[model samples]
Target: MRLRLLLCVLCWLGTTPALAAENSRVLTTIKPLQQIAAAVMKDIDTPALLMEPGASPHSYALRPSDRRALAEAERIYWIGPELELFLQDLLERQDSAVDLLHLPQMAVRKQQQAHNFQKDEHASHAHGHEHDHGSLDAHIWLSPDNAKVVARYMAEDLASVYPQHVDQLQANLAVFERSLTALDDRLQVRLSPLRDKPYFVFHDGYGYFEDHYGVKPQGIFSLSHEVQPGARHVNQLRQQLQAAGPSCVFTEPQFTPRLVNSLTQGLPVTVGVLDPLGSAIDVGPKGYEHMLEDMSGALADCLEAL
Candidate 1:
């Protein structure tokens, strides 16, 4: 009788874990997507994020460990080939067991060229150096509207995989949407003064942000860290910056400031940095909201300084 009880206990223990594992396991590409996945899987133990702090997904090469994690995850979400160029083949080859959530699926907007950041004399100035890069701005999470779409998708995915959590996922989605709506209202009011304002960015990742807020960026100095502006593009941008006389020209942390310095030379413009991602500021758990707020405040401060 005692032996029978022990066997039954072991069987129950094994079955419980197997059942739990069958419920859900998610892995996302970036920190922003991690936060979204976290909200959707609020009831889960923990989800995984592929990109780490200070890691550049633009040119990140996958390690063997990364491949193992991707193969193990139940679902994985990312902005698509624009950023994860290296993962394209891996994703395609992924077994049917792993679910892939490509954000730019049926709702993909027309793609745009990345911002330019190369100086006119980039090639000549390289001290025996050559750099090759092909990446468009993959910072789609910067826009609140896009965030809403992703949040909704994440919630649906969570519910679909774990039907028992359908109610919980629905509630989470409503809460996420409400938070986004509140953030959007605050941003609209805060950025109202600068709605029609002409500005410039070190990179062109702000197109969605600018479009949503009715602001027009004067020009893109660089697309990603790897892209450099050619001589002709630099001259054209220089002329535009001079003509527009934008209040501020922004740069990011990951890239060089060489292009920024060259473009703003002899031009009356204050240089500021806008982090489309929440690296510079402590945006809190709601990092997406924090990113938008920091950007608005930074732009406002720059404009007021002028």
Candidate 2:
């Protein structure tokens, strides 16, 4: 009887990997972070995503459902207040939240001021909030290397929460790292042909990717992610667009293309869509890689046409 009981106990222990992790109700503010966390927590848990697809984090108003999710979440992961300005004070109230922006070894790109980028739309918004990024560009996840760092940091965090799944989490992170290397090599080979090919972006959110891959844009229409350029700024952008002739102009899915189209009309420019936030991408292990691949494809396709 004792021997039979010992065998049953061992079988139950072995089956624990298939069970839900302890305190696994993880929540992430954006799709990319959710994707990263999902990859790290593979086989153990799937983090609940807060921001809906096609929603702009910069301008997203929290719904009742989102508020409920926040209330119930055991742990939360987000970039920081700089990118998701809407989540600043709310996150301060959540003790379980982890701000990945301040993670060790993060390479934050400071916002480079264009003489044309004088007006910050957030400073003069309809909402009476003044959001100064402290000149920090919060689009850090666009860098593939940054994605790896995020996964590493995320794995470390998850390991603490679910110590029972530590081995699986570490294994998931290793798989993520190896897969990232393969994706980086492929992106380099694919985007290598379009080096120095000038392009224009509707929003200045691709600085991290551009800097990482050496495919910088020629000019930007707006400095803020969620605002349209004013008439004065539009005029300046038009002059700049006219100067950057025979190039490609990229528009984002989250914002309207009306301004971009108007500026590029009658100019030797091809308009292309670049989804910086990967709003259309489904949350999964390959979400980050797919976002970079999609952006690189859009760039190469548009630039090659010009």
Least lDDT summed over 10 consecutive residues: which range in candidate 1? 123-132
Residue-pair clashes per prediction, in order, are: 8, 0
Model 1 spans with C-alpha error above 4 angstroms: 1-24, 95-107, 114-138, 160-163, 223-239, 280-285
Q: Compose the digit string of candidate 2's lDDT tens values, residues 103-206.
A: 77898877654434455453133111233445777778888889999998888877778989999999999998999899889888878878888887755578
Reference-based TM-score of each model? 0.74, 0.83
Best model per TM-score: 2
Model 1 lDDT, full chain set:
0.64
lDDT of each: 0.64, 0.75
RMSD (CA, Å), each prediction: 9.6, 10.1
Best lDDT among the predictions, by candidate number? 2
lDDT, candidate 2, residue 123?
A: 18
